[model samples]
Target chain A: MRPMPGNAAERGYALSEVSCDALLREFRKDFRIFAPVRLEGRGRFSDTDMVRYGEIRNFREMELREKSLFSPKEVLFPPSETLFHFAETGVREPSLLREDGKGLLVLLRACDIAGVDRLDAIFLGNGPEKDPYYEARRKRVVFALIECGPLGASRSGSFGSCFCVSMGTNRASGYALVLRPEDDGLSLFLEDPAFAAYLPPDAVRTSYAPSFPLEDPFPVRVPDPGDMSRAVREESLFSAAFWKDYDSRCIACGRCNTVCPTCSCFTTYDVTYEENASAGERRRVWAGCHVDRFTDMAGGHRFREKYGARMRFKTMHKIHDFHLRFGRHMCVGCGRCDDACPEYISFAACIDRVSRVVDAAASTGGDDHDAR
Target chain B: MPRDIVRKKITKNAYRITSKRAETCLRVRVPGGHLDACLLDVVRSIAERFGDGTVHLTTRQGFEIPGIPWERMAEVNKAVRPLLEALEVPLGVTFVDLDGGYPGAGTRNISACIGNRVCPFANYDTTALAGRIEAAVFPHDFHVKIAVTGCPNDCIKAHMQDFGIIGQAMVEQDASRCIGCEACAKNCLKRVTGAISMKNNRAVRDPRRCIGCGECVLVCPTGAWSRDPRKYFRMVILGRTGKKNPRMAATFLEWADEEVVLTVLRNCYAFIDAHIDRSLPKEHLGYIVDRAGWPAFREAVLQGVSLDPPLRVAETLEFSGYFYERDRVFR
Candidate 1:
């Protein structure tokens, strides 16, 4: 609960001297240091020691300019890993041990800070499968958030849907390390002044306003409270034509769910080698709503068959149902979905489309638009 | 998220308590007709006696008790194994085959878009292909993802998939219905061609220039412009436009013939299952074919057709439909 670095009492290195090397020296001591080191032209976050930090002298060099090519969700919840290992011996009950914990990941984006919060809500917010491995890493790490400034060029197309600015996730809070460029050097702010005192003068001190302004035109609106109950009456939603058309462009790729900030669905995999099925660990990895086998059981009855039904369930749950329970919209608008979607099936755009449809229905009929 | 809270209300009886090491898992399917309370009790009792009393919900609409001790895990199998044998649930391969459950096997590979033509974005029907493949292919435990895109916007993450089928323009159009509004030209993300010029109130289209993203069809009003009938409903396969193991789904087949596509898919599934070990994660069909040799496997499985040496994979396909991009201004 100490003040961030750059207070009158404790001043870190001068802005210029706080080169990548200096920062690495400070970071590598304990934390598994991560920073927005440049990769090719675009910026990618990686282990701090792996890249040349000298290339990152000031904030300009730091790729805090735009959304990092990837979200830091994996830092806490990886794509795949064994939660525990299970094997049987003769007559004894099979013994299971928890996975080892790798502590502290240093991610530098403001949006990712909020993204971590969202992930926490999903994984640890009272579910039966509150992954202990995820919890261990999550609790151990501190978020080092660098604010955004200007735009950088991207390798991929489909940027139209990535409007993280509208999600109010464009800044960092809680335990944060802020950097601001100054004439003398830079000012650094840390949550702990004692920790800040170790640094030389001229560190960076930075500040950020909420990216998603209240006046922003595309504020995410929560669906009607009774939309679920009323949706049943709106039988048009259940129509075959509606579903086919809506899901016509679906590629069944799990990218949206994979890149999303809050998607927590996963499947347990029992990976065995040719030599030893007994030695392989029991792994749980991220899964998505879009994937068809996500619901397939021993038998072939798919619960969310019909492309449209999957589309509708994923969309409606994000706005109407999730908000009703979580007290907030599930989406932080990372725009990853927009970028990740090969078909550009932007959920945000879909929400807007559905909203307009309901609004039109409401205007025509006295009662609320049937959500079904 | 609210429903998740409701879904989180796991009844004490619904869980099977067991250790984590159990090699086998007990999957249970609860139908709408069954009494929820009774099922919960039976499931919970089974968990208490055999499992560790904890149930994990699968993405595929079933629940499993992870970490069951290897010794007792075999016993856990007995509980649901009988139910699977009974005609009661109609278990497909395993027990708890809930209708509408997530089909993780072949579904992970193929690109089946929603019937979005019914809503707004669809250029073709996706469900028909999904159903056809589901019936024809006897897929082993393989994960293949397929994407169905109706238009150019590609809203369904089609590009980032192993198999992607995007809608394309079918034909050259008549200018009389064009309206010279620039709707079609402006809406086309790829800039299909300079043929459809609004300045002259007349437009000419280059059929070769179109990749069939279907943007022009969606924007065109008065139906002057249309997709080529021959090209409509064309199917492309075997592209892995994904981040992890990036590979393109090869277009070894075309047309929307559900049965024919099924034959090819069944063959593909057999080849993959036979050649590639399921132990190794199979990212794309092209990769598997490349490593294991496609011609040899194809000849082994596909007896009738003489195999071609040079593989001309279809990168794109065309489709026809009444298309409409959601007009932000009007809405």
Candidate 2:
């Protein structure tokens, strides 16, 4: 079920109100459940009260939010994943990595679940080669969507820069359950009967809400996908002056790419042992368009030498370019990038500024609008 | 208890060298984002001799010497000890982690912007203040993030840090020194704040409207406007981005003096000591504050600390994030 306003078909799911602690306790007995957990101190990325995905050890620790600062994608696609390990000779097969035998359960928001679907498209479906590592992690997991309300400190559902409604990712399906806030705890709605076995044996069931709030409380709209593509075209924006001012403002911190749930780019390297050069491991780590070495190639020709060019590439990929190639837009409109940016660069604001430039350029018929 | 148990303390110590196996990167502290040319040679020599040839310029205004082998940590430490002395970093007395490896995973490297020493928008000396803070807070096994910026423009992003210190200046206008240049008024009206206006061939400043960014001081040609010798700061607390919620920090102190700020910092330590759970590996001070409730936290942090007049403390901190009220998870 979606939020309120429009009737959200429960489909085949059974909704029941129960205590959050109780729900988590029951789930923990059977599966490895991941939830939003507060860090004890400075985490890997930042020093804020950043929440990250961790195993739910305590029933009370399973907290929900409007959105997490970082995505739960780390559970499926880690910041670093070792593809294989090699020994002696040139290339020996990779050593086996440990895997949790039991299935996994994750509590996610609507946009994040949609982000999972977008990732699934690239790694699991309609691709030339399916990633076995990603598939292994993805196939064994279950998802439960959290319906966001006007819950203070629970600002995970709607973001000021969010455009999920416009992108048609506001409502999430294909999950095992959908949770809505009841008086003190949560109303656990079960979609897949297989997951119901994890609920308390004596638990009685209720029905999910017929509707959910379709539009974001505060939505920032982007231009038509086709128009956005044209606006970001080489001919139109190559010489546009709007993106030139970021040289001083942007420090290329790579915070945008780290916080984005849809970003799936990775850079791989071989880590050979000093004692035995023959024994090495191939590791895949996270990489993004904002970092300095993102475009560096073997011949020393960097495609995006300028910061603005890199910013343009990132923006186009997020809003227009990726959507053009893939049937669905890569961005889930979660708006984590805006919150995570230290320079306070708003990707949503870029669309507004770029749209005006595109309109002006279209009207003037290639007239230069350099304000620099 | 010996710290460094779960994972390597590299991330907490501002060292990120996961790209290479068995190699640790050391994030050399550069207070206020400025360093002497002499220190560069020291860093370069160490990098070339002990580690890889490349040194990364971290976004936090520091240097990261990557590719240092794990075994040469002590040698690297000895070579770089003099550079730390020049930077006035507290060595043997405090923050002496990294003997065998970076073991302590608490206080991060202090970050600051170039203040009045360079930038026109600055109000106070940011680098000097960052050094003082590092002296007071570093080497502890408690997680804290502090950043100092010269003005409200917030180049260093003071608001997002665990302890944010933003500089502010009180401006005074001397009518006798006014030459009617109108430069101060012009800048105030356009770029900065329109807190000053030309009246009767002399400049009059509106104290309430001024943001104290020192725009008037920079524009004054005849020394008509000057900054007050007294230093002022605004302290913001508890802003964080995490799994459950992400919210900017709320102001705890406005127009506070040096003593009040120091006392508060001291009390933060005391409060953490009193309330930190023994079972958990570590606990963020912000989370501790949330779990302890605002009343207990406010009283503990402000115990015996007197605030200067007109410097108000927040009566009710309007935190916009979620925490577990039904149960505590640290155990």
Candidate 3:
């Protein structure tokens, strides 16, 4: 149903009461609740049975304010799922198949929210009918927006962070429990006044003031899709020197795919029981595009083998090629690729660097100026 | 007409104009520009005016319009000349399957993961290696799917491709960090060989017992651990656990180069190209290898290498090399 302010059709609640009873009850019915928690000396989103409301004392207690340490893509599209159950005879049927009308609830920072929206455009809107399995999980949930307050110290991260401000995803308005703490305790702003009445005095500070963008002007601009093909072709002229540096630092963890909201690729397997060889489950799990084995079809003919070439595929798909084919950038600038990277390969920075090279090359008009 | 390649539906704005009476299919793409929208409309209008009112989406992410007769090819090309320039989309010999054969499964052939640079389970830089392989090998007509995963978790399913590589960690567990917590002992599915008996309820891993899946590393609460920076990757050949005779692939090589990997892949492809009849329809690589005899063919095609004992003599009809052709890169 289309969202409407509470009146005859719907109603609002105070943020505190939403957190106290209503929110927890509503959340528990569907979601396996998750919030930021300290685990093994670091903070992360993990499942805990400690509180009925799945406690988040304040925004500070929330996991990384910059963006989620992990992307919520796993909530719907897990690392691995059973594609179907099978027997040795080649006959099979679905096992643990998720129903089509399920939903999920995620506490998302603005960047990831944007990422999900981008994913919606790719997976649900433009392409085929949303994958029935993915759609079942996607349609079931809602988003709870959390505003990022400030950057942390040791900021080894890039100055041109994939900030929500630049990505046009700094704030959310669909279904939120905005927090503002005052004297009584913590004040929660809710949609329903009845939910609001249950709040302790001065517990929640309610204000309509919206946070301003962290920096004045958004620094990044998407490279035009029209210029991509020639730019990519030109990039191939450069030798392996440029690629070797990036490859040296790479650790093939596949986290960037996991954290990316729009990375919808997957792989499948037919898992069978040991004793009951007649029965096994077929599983489909998320697969990354940046792996050595990803392109080896039959007979060992690998299509893309150079580090530079793989980088070319990723950047082009995100900015150029995908846009040409699907009319949208595959990336939403969530910056998870930057943060999740231990060696700290920033996708945004990479794009920015490549775009400069492309622009310079384009201006030269295909002349071999550097290497004679 | 092949029923497999029949007219499923007719959509507009996908392909260039087609003739009203041709047996073979002709696909034309509009160039890339703002005029793409306009060209889409123009192409759609033309298709309706001359032939059918629909276009087909191919696995390579291109569009095709059928019902074109051979005689009208020149006329069709002539009619769409202006629009082609404006659109900037090129049309040529397009393979029906380019990406993963299943779009629902994701990008195929040259698939790469984000890698350990960002992931918790990473043993090494899978992205770098995957990228290295993608660029160096130089592709052939038949797409070869290569997969790379950073750790034993096998997140990318590297073991399932024609050629696959998975990163493994060299690690040692400190006894002092052992809290007797059964988490590591319990979480391990491989039943790693190295583990000190549980004491004070905490279990310690014997360096020898670890298969290096890192499940214990992930679950361990005590910070008592040392991991080597030099995580090694194991190369796996021919592993597709899919329909039509699924099988688990075996390890082929270990500790090879970015260059060595490329050399082996190129040589293998050259072998397949030389031996397999391109004119005939071939379902998979294993099928050809099975029919052709593995040892004799390997001797002829992959001349330089010392053939692994298991691969050379394994009797399983489906060799590990030719699995499934999922994405644009067929495997």
TM-score computed on alpha carbons, candidate 2: 0.50
> Please, what are the lDDT tens digits per residue for candidate 2 over residues B1-331?
3323224454554455567777878877776677779889988997899879889887667788988876676688777676667764442324354343333437666789887677756767788788777667655678777788988888888877778888877766656445444667777899877988865445788876777777676555333466666788888888776654556778888788877776777678888888887688767777788788778888887877776575778888776655544354565
Superposition error at A295 for model 2 (Å): 0.6
When 1 and 3 are scored with TM-score, the better candidate is 3
Evaluated at residue A326, the lDDT of candidate 3 is 69
DockQ of each: 0.01, 0.01, 0.01
Model 2, A30-118: lDDT tens per residue? 67888777643222211123366778865456556435667888788876666887885555443323554667788877778888887
* Candidate No. with top TM-score: 2
Per-residue lDDT of model 1, residues B1-331, tens digit only? 1212111112111323333322334445422112235455556766677666777655333356554444553355456544333312342333243332222333442334444435355555554444343444322345555555555455555555544555544444654233344456654533644434443333455544555555554444223455444324334444453443444334444333333344455566666666666666344565576577656644643444333421123423322222133463357
Clashes of each: 116, 20, 114
Candidate 2, residue A88: the lDDT equals: 59
> Model 2 chain A, poorest ten-residue lDDT window?
A40-49
Which parts of model 3 are misplaced by more than 4 Å?
Answer: A1-22, A29-37, A41-66, A87-103, A149-161, A171-205, A208-212, A216-221, A233-241, A368-372, B1-208, B211-331
lDDT of the candidates, in the order given: 0.49, 0.69, 0.50
Question: Tens-digit lDDT track for model 3 on B1-331?
Answer: 4223223121111222334324334454311111345667756754665546676654322345566554444455556655544433122212233321111111133444546556766665665565455444422345455677766666666666666776655445655334333446655643544353453233655654555555555544332333544445556666665455455556655544344455667676656676676666433554455566667544543456554421222233334343354753654
lDDT of 3 by residue, A54-166 (tens): 23434334443234444666565655555565665675434224443324556655556666766666668766576656666677656654444344111312324554554
Q: In candidate 2, how many Å is residue A217 off?
A: 4.4
